[model samples]
Target chain A: MPYVTVKMLPGRTVEQKRALIEKVTDAVSETTNAPKENITVFIEEMDATHYGQAGVMHADKK
Target chain B: MPYVTVKMLPGRTVEQKRALIEKVTDAVSETTNAPKENITVFIEEMDATHYGQAGVMHADKK
Candidate 1:
């Protein structure tokens, strides 16, 4: 089973998330040839304070 | 390039999370031979309603 996870900031609306899951499922299915039903998708929403990049926290960005 | 994610229910203490990341990083390093610095660990906390098993939501389980 190919489990796909989308990790990003936490402000998307429900409709956006719905579209994201559908589109991601289709893309992964097309590339990996896995059935849509068998592909699991997990959305991880991270707060700015909890995420860091290039040795700096997102919350500290100016 | 080895990215490990630990997905579980919420409520672990900060010390527990610290130990978890350390132990998991070490284990992955030992198994995959990836350097400790090259490994990235993400912790995902899921509510019972957001997770399901065997076609049943975790929140619905008794």
Candidate 2:
């Protein structure tokens, strides 16, 4: 099964995440010709201190 | 950091996914006020046979 993980900052409402998962799943299914039921999408929200990018930690970046 | 999983069908160009990650990351960062570096995103692709939804396996749904 396709298990998709989306990590980003927090503060998203449940509705937003639900819409995102549905839209993303549909997009991937249509594009790849895969079954919708097999698509598994998950979202993770983290704090600035937990992530790092471009040689700078998120806490430091912001 | 937020760890997001995006499970979808395969066969997408790397560029499409790269853009997706960048855009999604930015959206989340701005919306949640989280740092960019802390966001961790991962994508997983699975065969129809490996996934199931609505009481039906993807292989059967397809």
Worst 10 residues of 1 chain A by lDDT: A49-58
Top candidate (DockQ): 2
Off by over 4 Å in 1: A1-44, A47-62
Q: What lDDT is reached at residue B7 by model 1?
A: 79
lDDT tens readout by residue for model 1, B1-62: 67776778887776566667667778888898888777766667899999999999998996
TM-score for candidate 1, please give it: 0.53
Highest lDDT against the true fold, candidate: 1
Candidate 1: count of backbone clashes, pairs at least 3 residues apart or interchain: 0
Residue A39 deviation, candidate 2, in Å?
Answer: 1.0
Clash pairs (backbone) in predicted model 1: none
The digit string of per-residue lDDT tens for model 1 on A1-62 reads 79988998889999999999999999999999999999989998975544433323345565
- For all candidates, state DockQ relative to the true structure: 0.10, 0.32
